[model samples]
Target: MDDLARLVATEDVRRVMARYVYSADHHRWDDLAALFLPDAPFIASTVDGSVQARMTGRDDIAGQLKARNHPDSVLVHHLFSSEIDFESEDSATGVWAMEDIVTRPAGEPAGMHGYGHYRVRFTRLDGRWLIAELRITRLRLDWTY
Candidate 1:
């Protein structure tokens, strides 16, 4: 692809990443699920390299996220410094610096603040960019009770 096409594709992928954060934080489960490939792999791990959750397929991924951010929970995700590289016209990879805060109900534990990097693979399916693989590696996590 030409420079212009590549730029456009990169922007599209960035938009999708932003949408992922927005949808999750807003509890838009259906919208978030639509951002991934049908059978995508989603893995999340901590700073010590311990896996937190490993899920395959959009439905499972969405369900897991929803469960974490329930009705009495507030989730905020911030992403920055994204590095996206195109592998082909329809495929790319990216790594983004991220931070998230989760606040639970008053009766429960306070919640957690985390910093991480999200490594992801993107594929264009049916003319829309979708996440094919996602791995989140946390750099730090702090909890409050």
Candidate 2:
């Protein structure tokens, strides 16, 4: 890819990542699922290396996220320092520093705040960039009771 093309692709990938965070925090499950490929794989794990969940396909991803971030929950995700590397005209990989705060309803546990990084693979499908693979690794977590 040309310099300009590569730059544009990088920016597009960044936008996709931003959209993913926005949709997830806002409980926009359908929009969140649309940010990924139909058969994409998603894995989330804790800092200590325990697997939180593993999901394949957009439908499953959306369902799982909905279950985790329910109606009585409030989530906020902040992404920073994203580095995107283009491997080809249609493919790239990126890592992002992230922090998230989640709060449940009054009767539930107080809340959770976590810091992490997201490693992802992006694919340009049908002229649009989409997440093909994603794994979130936590660096730290704090809970309030």
Computed on alpha carbons, the lDDT of every model, listed in order, comes to 0.91, 0.91
lDDT of 2 by residue, 1-145 (tens): 9999998998999999989988988899989998989999999898898997999999999999887765878899999999889999999999999999998887775688989999999999989999999999999988866
Instruction: Report the alpha-carbon TM-score of model 2 versus the true structure.
Output: 0.95
Worst 10 residues of 2 by lDDT: 65-74
**What is the lDDT for 4 in model 2?**
96
Q: How many residue pairs clash in each candidate?
A: 0, 0
The list of candidate 1 runs beyond 4 A from truth reads none
Tens digit of per-residue lDDT, candidate 1, span 1-145: 9999999999999999999999978889879888989999999998899998898898898788777765878889999999999999999999999999999888876698999999999999888999999999999999866
- TM-scores of all predicted structures: 0.95, 0.95
Give the Cα error of residue 100 in candidate 1, in Å: 0.5
Clashing pairs in model 2?
A: none
Residue 135 Cα positional deviation in candidate 2, in Å, after optimal superposition: 0.5
Residue 26's C-alpha lDDT in candidate 2? 84
